[model samples]
Target: MPDRVRPMRTVPRLGTYNGFGRTLLGRTKPDADGACFATHWFTLLLLPIRPLGRYYVKEGATVERSTGPGASTSTTEYVFLGEAELRASEVIRTYLFRWVVVPLVVAGPVTVFGLNSDAYSREHPLLFLLLLLGIPIGGIIVLAVALGLREKFLSSARVPEWVGSGPPRG
Candidate 1:
């Protein structure tokens, strides 16, 4: 007897090339056609080190809600018709924006304000101490605020035009 309700297995298995495929980024919100851009990366220590490739595909998820110990519930997957295309710019921009740009944007002003706004005066050694303390604390506070706004920030991110001309995968 043939199997029924077969989940569409991805033909080109990602994350297996070079014995590593990790960090799928630049996944667009579902387009009008219900497909999105999915970019995978090669990672070291779970940090995306380089881009592997990208595909225009339909995203999939399997959610298992559980209240048990060590139980994980959500997983995301992508389905592409054919080979993934190398899209270096999109991947790099996404990576750099997350790791570099966001850091500078978030922390730069905090640091500036901490340094310029707070003076380390010799008359009050406490001021010096507070300056030192406040820099890190203020930075942490700003960082926390940025983290809190992460979902909103992510929601507003723009998705670039997919270079792949092929039909969107489902």
Candidate 2:
């Protein structure tokens, strides 16, 4: 009988995104040269509708100078190598990542109000009640801010449809 050999298996890379709207999800782990495949998605709100092709991307850094006096910051940035097919699991990850963030989001206010309110509620009942109204106001402002930041980040993403493309990359 002829000898039989087993085929080698490759593991699909798994990645979670921190921001939404649309995304270029990493398709494979970065190789030794720091290049990988990433697929950009077309989305409606949080739901991913279609992949825009897989593009090659390289991991790199983006530096931004502050408008103020001599301040600058560097953030990890991806150089698009050019490719989009979004899997259901990747869409699900969008939801999962937000769920994971919920507790920490809720915790901040709860902790702040819980720790500070006892005396305030008892001594200044009306003011304490009024302070509760600020929660929704703060939430609206936060939502606006989050959307704005998503725009800034996506500007460099070459996101095809959902949002507009930023800059051309390799």
Candidate 3:
């Protein structure tokens, strides 16, 4: 009887995955070579919403690996594409809209409710309190969903063919 040979297994190479960044909420993770991936999570906190919502942004390179002449020969390449910076002006604009504008717009209703609390409570105490509490909670939930959808749209729009593109450069 002839002896059977075992097939060789190939293992994927491991690289660094460290995070670093500074903002309201953001992180960076290094990839192979000199490229790194970054993600930013922007949130608004004001008005009736305790935590308004989040907007996410990502920047990084695309990596592509191709096999050479031999099965053991493989080459890895990188391509740098995507938004690299988060401008302060844009962030300030978003902040102002969420913090100042939103609160000012909501103040009218809140003031009316405050002034009529006595009559409102007398008529429907439970509902009055519920309205006050539900405002913030409902705002949070609605804003969260909206932001989540926006994030998905923005991420998809940024790079439709990001996969197998190549690694990013500085």
Task: Identify the runs in model 3 with alpha carbons over 4 angstroms from their true place.
Answer: 1-23, 26-89, 101-109, 154-170
What's the true lDDT of residue 145 in model 1?
A: 80
Task: Encode model 2's per-residue lDDT on 102-141: one tens digit a residue.
Answer: 4345446756886879988999888776666666457557
Q: Residue by residue across 79-127, what tens digits does model 1's lDDT show?
A: 6633344656667767786677655765665567556654445566777
Worst 10-residue lDDT window for candidate 1 reads 1-10
Candidate 3 lDDT by residue in tens digits, 1-170? 11111121222121221212112232222223333322233222321222212222233344545456543322233232333334354455555656675565445455667786888788998998888777656656666776676655543232122323332334
lDDT order, best first, reads 1, 2, 3
Higher-TM-score candidate of 1 and 3:
1
TM-score of every candidate relative to the true structure = 0.48, 0.37, 0.39
What order do candidates take by TM-score, descending? 1, 3, 2
TM-score of 2: 0.37
Q: Candidate 1: list runs displaced more than 4 Å.
A: 1-21, 44-46, 62-73, 107-170
> lDDT score, residue 26, model 3?
23
Residue 19 accuracy (lDDT) in model 3: 19
Q: After superposition, how far is residue 170 of candidate 2 from its true place, in Å?
A: 10
- For model 2 the local lDDT of residue 62 reads 57
